[model samples]
Target: MPFVQEALDGIEFARGDPNSTWGSVRAAMGHPEPFTLKYVAIGNEDCWKPHYRENYLKFYAAIRKAYPDIKMISNCDGSNAQLDHPADMYDFHIYQNANTVFSMANTFDRTSRVGPKAFVSEYAVTGDDAGRGSLLAALAEAAFLIGLEKNSDIVEMASYAPLFVNTNDRRWNPDAIVFDSSQAYGTPSYWMQHFFSDSNGATLLKSTLQANSSNSLEASAILFQNPMDKGNYMRIKVVNFGSSPVDLKIVIDGFDRKLLDSSGSKTVLSSTNVKDENSFANPEKVVAQVSPVKSLVEKTGTNMDLVLLPHSLTCFDVLMKSDITQITADDDSHVSSM
Candidate 1:
């Protein structure tokens, strides 16, 4: 208990005012500004251990009293069940096979909206399917992330585990970035993160995949503004986990009849083979390819047919002519805009 208190005190001092006790020490070390530390976890993956709840309560009470504004995270997963203890948020971790991880995109679909939000602090596609970071693993993780985007209300945060690994001594396999003393390169999983870079504050648009028989398709749409050009764009990200190609028809409802311009781009993150990986010798083997979308023009009510590649993650970025600040759903059926 003493040790935990001391640790908490130090953390508080680090983020405290420069006039405070430990903040003075930090200032004397040449830095005066406090670090932005808002979230803290009681313990990592220790909810099932003996006496974890007892010790956790003590720590929680102390922290709650000292720093009430800081969001405390509990290790217990409250996704499927309500937590007995109090927490601002709960930690959720998953390390599973490709198929399972892909299907788990809807893992939080049925979670209660009244409880603490979930912090998926750790997640990855592991085992033989994710051998040293393969395209297959990246595709599955992308699909899962699309699910998270659809359920972002309940999921406060999510991240890929084992971010960087040294090539010389790889204690953990399938890391996102691989590094050596001289050079560095990103795996397919690392490049996959680029697909969601614009999703932080973007507005999620309603999207649906009307397939007859295939259950291997997952997709989501978002409306985001380009920081550079200051133009609004609609990005439709889709992941096809099966081997068969899909001819998907994208219909944008509640959109202007001639709003879409011909100047649009399509970005795809895929490779020739599913299990293909990137090494120092061939870093660009499995990377995202950007191309112009020639088919999209001043279409009528935004009706377009898209061919999704098998086992690939594709993003169709269509530039919007006007800024869409708000959208209301139709009464009869929920309409999705591409």
Candidate 2:
């Protein structure tokens, strides 16, 4: 394979182009080291079109023959109707209101587990409910992401859309990061991603909540290593979608009280108003505010009760101080003197 450094060279990648681009990888890199190319998607949102399958077959045949290890994604969705061609995965794009997207976290729960895995290439909260990536939008999207994290087995990958918007040029609104002139600011949608940036290969936990407001809440727990010290810690993330504050009892089914940190910091994304957006005059109007949770005196040993604000996203990063019980799942008696 040859490395393609330009569009003309890439154009040769078509199925039968005389100067095919697939054969340039070796020459471009000056070596035969395999490129870590695992996934490639066809045209987006072109499903159900007559020419889609036709165009897809050409690339599919050429790529499959040239690189048999590469996994191909079809533009058509076989989640509902089976496509005539073979594909390793399907592209599923979605755009809806904040409230609707909140419920969309469970979108793939009913999909048949036997078919191609789902690749949510594009999704975001738009329309009147989302004014240039407002807090309401981020809260809903955070919940939806939690659902994706829970069902990651079938959901191969997912991503947010409108990643950038140039204030100088009026084009797409509700972007994750907005920039213009000499300054750049991240929307709530952008800050919300920080909470999940380290979950890529981290170990996910089975954390459960028992409260009357549980239905309006979405959460996922994971044990990720700290980059500075490489120490493992339990990070619990939650998104509250209701109007009233929730008194959540943070219960870990597999963690011991002795290993828990003396106290942790809570990062929350909320504002005086749900529809608040960042402006040049007030860039920090809507951002993830970090505050120490050292005053957590309301708990029953390993069971700690934290109050969750309504329409907000929160994460508690508790450090692992020392070795504790290695039991898999049990509510250990809280040792106050840890």
Candidate 3:
């Protein structure tokens, strides 16, 4: 396999085309065998060029004849397309503010039919450099991702684009993850990626949250069924963004358990000064801490007033006592602090 250019040159029909030659050379240097690439796009923003459509069709037809499994994707302006023209994927970009990002979760909620999956390949908080690449943006990104996770059955894949930019030599508006020479640091948006990636559970369980008000307190409960145990357990994630502490009284119904143990933990990402951020100089500026939560005695359920710091993420795991009969009620069951 020559590169993309050579592969295109090897095609007797595409010998004289420069763009075809480029694609051929791309394939050759990367792979020896006929590349099993599934998707290929023609032009990017330049799809509207005068010769681009014809060139795209030529490559598409050639690739289709050569490998039917490969799918051709083309960037086209406007909503309408030739019904007979073939395309396997459609790309859509979004760069709205926080309000719009919050509303987008329900944008396709009424979508009736499923066809080609949508790729939100590029998205970010636009406008206001003050909040553009700040930690608040990361919190918004996390909220947006919660929507994506809810709609993953429809969305095939999504990527945050304009991913990196040198602060001194920025060509675009702003990159989601940015760093300068000698130091690589993640923005608030970057933390959203880590939070989602690190906290993804084995399964997306059907759970619900009970909140007094959307602004003050919000809590989510996810039931994780243990493979070894016939009974299931619960993991509660509570976020208190308010200035005051919230007293969370949780009662889980429809489960039998002899041992019910619950521990609360808090991860504070806030600072005494609202504008503080973790940099290479002081890496541990914002971190999570494990504090002892008050236990409920003489009761079957758990109750505690969780002092969640303002603008913080807290995770709590509850393990049901497997063999309640083995221990005496007077016996002190050691609760592991998170």
Which one wins on lDDT? Answer: 1
Best by TM-score: 1
**Candidate 1 lDDT tens digits, 234-309:** 8888898988888886665555535556678999987789999999999989999999976665542366667888
Better of 2 and 3 by lDDT: 2
Regions of candidate 2 where Cα sits further than 4 Å from its true position: 1-36, 78-84, 295-298, 322-338
What is candidate 3's lDDT per residue for 4-71, written digit by digit as tens?
44444444222223335444554455632343456666557655578766666677677677757655
- TM for candidate 3 is 0.61
Error of 2 at 160 (Å): 1.2
Tell me the TM-score of each prediction against the true structure.
0.93, 0.83, 0.61
lDDT of 2 by residue, 200-285 (tens): 66556666787669878998876667777676666789999888899988666766676676677789999878899887778888
Model 1: residues with Cα > 4 Å off, grouped in runs: 297-301, 326-338
lDDT of 3: 0.49
How much lDDT does each candidate structure score? 0.83, 0.75, 0.49
